[model samples]
Target: MSLSDAAELLDVHKSTALRILQTLEAARFVRKTGAGTYVFGSGLIELSELTLGSMDLRQHAGGLLRDLQRRTGHTVHLAQLIGDEIIYVDKVDSPAFQAVQLPSRVGHAVSIYASAVGKVILAYLPRQERDRLLSHVVFERYTPTTFADRDSLEVELAGIRQRGWAVDNGEHDSYVMCVAVPVRDSRGQTVAAISVTAIEVVATLAKLEENLPLLFATARDVSAEMGHSA
Candidate 1:
């Protein structure tokens, strides 16, 4: 909505609305579109991490995560965005791929530019938001495959959007491969993600490809249970 419209709706002056919007923009609570329009910020979804909504989301998603873990025998993770970072809220570990999974606690923050789940969430966000996030990220290469610059990362994100999934390919480490897909909300907005990780030695890109349908199907099921019809 336009600033003037928002001002009228809130019964505030245009200047006051603009100032409030600017503050929310700084905090990533709202994002502007077009010349003066605004929409709920994708980062608001990030803030959902600490809310009862996130707990409910985890509960709704747990069974699907477990089933995916059992069917693939690969570690599964449920992650939500927090600004430019992603946090693991729940996981189901595969005994066979125990070493393949990274040592992550329930709230361990992961890089949005280097991890599978992070990239998938970023890749599906509005372009302006993705650009805004890219501006703030310092591309510290974690491994040989890590994106060294914004240009490369942008290209990869575009490819990920088209492919409907993302891969870590050892960008965060040299031994693990992670595959992730988006979890949409009622509005078809990707508010979270699910990922499967395995040792590169045991599972190649082709093997990860084979699991894509399973992973995506599980993500869909979770989204559905969260009241998303999409």
Candidate 2:
């Protein structure tokens, strides 16, 4: 729609419509045509697809995630690589950790290089896609353990690829620890990750690693539900 049409439909001033269109265009949610009209952009389409796809993934993985949380008595998170960010698509809070709840929630974004879920998903992405995502990030050393630079993060990512999992040893928050494994789709693409997290007081990183076998099994089961084979 043109700015005039949009303003008419929205019952707003043309200046307001132009401002709205400009903001949307910046986010790539709308594109300004050469003719000075507006249309839905690829970003909007991609976000719509991510929403629908993540909904399906959440539904398919819900029970399994809850079961894993129950067995481990720790928080479980399912995060997906959505566009340029890694977003938590689902979470199962541990009943045992009511006193000190982890900060993660569904629909929240995680640091792409600092969190275990983020690293596992990034490690499995194609090199070009990985580079594209990292190119925009301004790394921060959230803790002494964070991979705050590209070179160090690359080494961590390489280890994750070799071992097929990632660990956050309080990288983002000194008290929080996590272990994550990749969740693959039908085409063997790593589209998401499953993580079990806890505070150091509840479970150290080593304690969390003890649950790796179960975590890996849960990831495989969820991946299978996503139509992955072998």
Candidate 3:
């Protein structure tokens, strides 16, 4: 698709799309052909391989997520922020017959302003960096609950930071709800987020509040296992 088409499809402006395309092209993740149409570039394959090789946390997270799934009986996800998106590195689904399946894959990217895991990380970022990142975002409304205004989103992010957790109440997808906690490094820098997602019917506010401690404890354990102190 042309830049204009892509921008419209993504609910973003043409200039924003052009800037993203240019950055991806400069990083060799995208290529503009003679017709001015962009395509995935060969360099992305190399970068993908390099990233896979360096993903030690993903390796460990798989097992940890499995344990969390067993303990909580909810879908557990481990994700890291990449640019303005969150990439799910690992996930484990509950065996419960009625459990909802989350559409998460190892390299799949999700909107930072939409998902609970993404919001947790975004909330902890420096204000200047957060504003810069949000300025480039289009704030697409995926559902009725999605935060589409910058001022409202900023206020919500402030709450996430103060609470040290994030909740997605059918924001990204109308039928899904998620609760996320940050995983910090040794220096207390937020590196990623771990979340439990389920169908809205099953992931009610009361249920999420009941499970909050378990989610926080698991995140702390994962952080410590990754060589983060405290």
Task: Report the poorest 10 consecutive residues by lDDT, candidate 2.
Answer: 94-103
In terms of lDDT, model 3 sits at 0.81
RMSD of each: 7.9, 2.7, 7.4
Which of candidates 2 and 3 reaches a greater lDDT?
2
Q: Give the per-residue lDDT digits (tens) of candidate 3, residues 110-219.
A: 77898898889889988887887787788788898898888888888999989889988888888878899998766787878999888867667558657788899889
Please report how far candidate 2 places residue 160 from its true position, in Å: 0.3
Worst-scoring 10-residue span by lDDT in model 1: 97-106
Residue runs of model 1 more than 4 Å from their true location after superposition: 1-50, 97-101
Residue-wise C-alpha lDDT for candidate 1, range 92-146, written one tens digit per residue: 8778845445665677777788888899999999999888877878788888899
Q: Evaluate all candidate structures by whole-model CA lDDT and list the values in order.
A: 0.85, 0.94, 0.81
Instruction: Report the Cα lDDT for residue 102, model 3.
Output: 65
- The C-alpha TM-scores of every prediction are 0.77, 0.88, 0.75
Superior candidate under lDDT, 1 versus 3: 1
Q: Model 1 Cα RMSD, Å? A: 7.9
lDDT of 2 by residue, 130-228 (tens): 999999999999999999999999999999999999999999999999999999999999999999999999899999999999999999999999999
- Clash-forming residue pairs, model 1: none
What's model 1's overall lDDT?
0.85
